[model samples]
Target: MESKMVIRQSIGFPRLVKWPRRVGYAAALWSLIFGALGLYWVLGGDGFPFGENDPRGQMMGSYLANLSVHVGGTMIALTGFLGIFAALAMVRKWNQKRLYFLLLFYAWVMCAILLFIIPDSRILQNVAYLFMFYFDLIDWIVIHQVFCMIGGVLWGTTALAYYRISRDACGNCGRAGEGASIISASKWGKVFTYCAVLTALPYGIVRFAWAIGIPLGTENIAIIGDFSGEAILGGLCFGGAILTLALIQKWGEVFPRWCLFIAGKRIPIWLVVIPATSVSVIIFLTGLKVSPQVVMMIINGEITMKNWGEMVPTLSWLPWGLSLGIATIAYYLRRRSRCKHCGKF
Candidate 1:
């Protein structure tokens, strides 16, 4: 058995060696393509996506909304060039401490801008709308946002691969001869799980109240106009809350008997991780765009404590997203099996 395991690992090791390089090359290509597009825009291309040219206009309130086409385009092109260099260096494993940390910092900053700062509430809303068959609602702007998010994911992947390789860790599993990862510890898993659940509740509860016309914290009856949307959103919130509990539950690993055909089977990891992570990112980005505006409104007396229901749930989104993301990571750490590529367990 030991010999067989060794042979399997030897076969897999070559692929592990190649994985980071492949990802790094991909990131470079992405940077090249996107950067060229930015250059085109800078050279008087007509379709600049942000500022007054944005279809949503001031409604988006994007951080890029104030920048001129030339300025934004120049910045984009510069980042793209930087990204190419970074990607190549990472692929080459240029591991000098200062240079490595600088590249890592650049990668994360790009990830944050693309993933969280550039995108706004529209992306989240349009995604939900897409599920509801509101096809007409999705436009070029949403598609652009999606592309930015994809870039963010790519940058994030590149960062992880670079970090693991530079640190001489297992490229596939990131295990450096560890007994267990701190993030995967059972206690931390439970803590983050409960935090996720708790943060989600206030929003769900408030939405439910509005759905039922209870006006839980508001005196305005007209706010209840068309309770259907509220009900659906409330249901989603509660459903999400319930799903969050699975991070700490036994049934998260094994399907319960209540599940018909899949009963007694171990759950697929990606099935849980992908959707949860996607939703968490969207929620966090939307909250990043919204929470500040809501706070400003409150301070300016544009929103009042009497209408707390309207704004408090919105504020919860930031924490809800953060907690959910951590909880999902914890769950993944606890549940992941031996790395197929590097034979890390």
Candidate 2:
């Protein structure tokens, strides 16, 4: 029987495992660096402005022109990148491990660009549409559904891979094969639960309103055409939330009642761990990419884009307010925990 390894003090990052984690870290770091550059361009007014007369008045010149899209997008992407780092740091081995987390992170990178960044960018919109048109012309392609199709496929594949991995015994198990649930707190589980709630609740409210024929405002349109997308998004939110909650009490560690043949059986770490880690990694890197943009905007008020005021509500204040609130709560929570190393908290 293999002897159990005890992980004590934090080992140097390089001493850890290879592949995904290392690749994830590199990606995250790159994003952080470039996101800063984008932010600098937006804030410094290095010729990117909003005035119609302003030759640089492309996307940044409209009602949607806001720093949040660029900066917020980077932050979202960076968060996923960080998730990857966390997963790699936590895991012990990587044999035939699925790359769901990494792929999800990539999808998130696309989301940050599409959801928050590109929607507001005239340049990006034109570029994207141009490509879409060309691609569609070359082949029979539903350009409008590209993002959804790609994201759905990635997430779907990851989810199925995770289910398969859960059946295999965890490599990190002890000699007697004690499971990860018995040994460590599931950070990925907790984080995933939190993310789903954060993203789904708000998105759900908007989606539900669209479902019954309600509108957030005159301009806000339902992204999900018909109820199919609404159902899928809502389902992902609900399912992910349920699994996370179950993990809190170890129910998820063992497959739940609905997994057919695998129901009521012990699940593998790679199953949940891989997907969770993949999503996190992707999210963290993407978030890192946007982080610089956020910081830059906050530092300098030089958004040369037109209709900057139109974006004040959502991009600038709302997310900042939420971030501040979350920070405060996190600080208090950490303080209450009284962790020895958490001096500031």
Q: Give one digit per residue, the lDDT tens place, for model 2 in 1-345.
A: 011111121123334323322343444344354345445544543422223323322323233234344454445345545534533332333343455455445545544443333222232223333533533322111232233233333333333333333444321111123223321233443453454445434434444444555544324353423465444444543454455444345564567687889797655434555454333333233233344554466468643243222222223223322332332223222212111122111
Per-residue lDDT of 120-147 in model 1, one digit per residue for the tens? Answer: 8888787766656677867766777788
Q: Count the backbone clashes (under 3 Å) in each candidate.
A: 0, 38
Per-candidate Cα RMSD to the true structure, in Å, reads: 3.6, 15.3
User: Candidate 1: which stretches are off by over 4 Å?
Assistant: 1-18, 55-58, 179-184, 219-222
TM-score of each: 0.89, 0.35
CA lDDT scores, all candidates in order: 0.80, 0.37
* Top model number, lDDT: 1
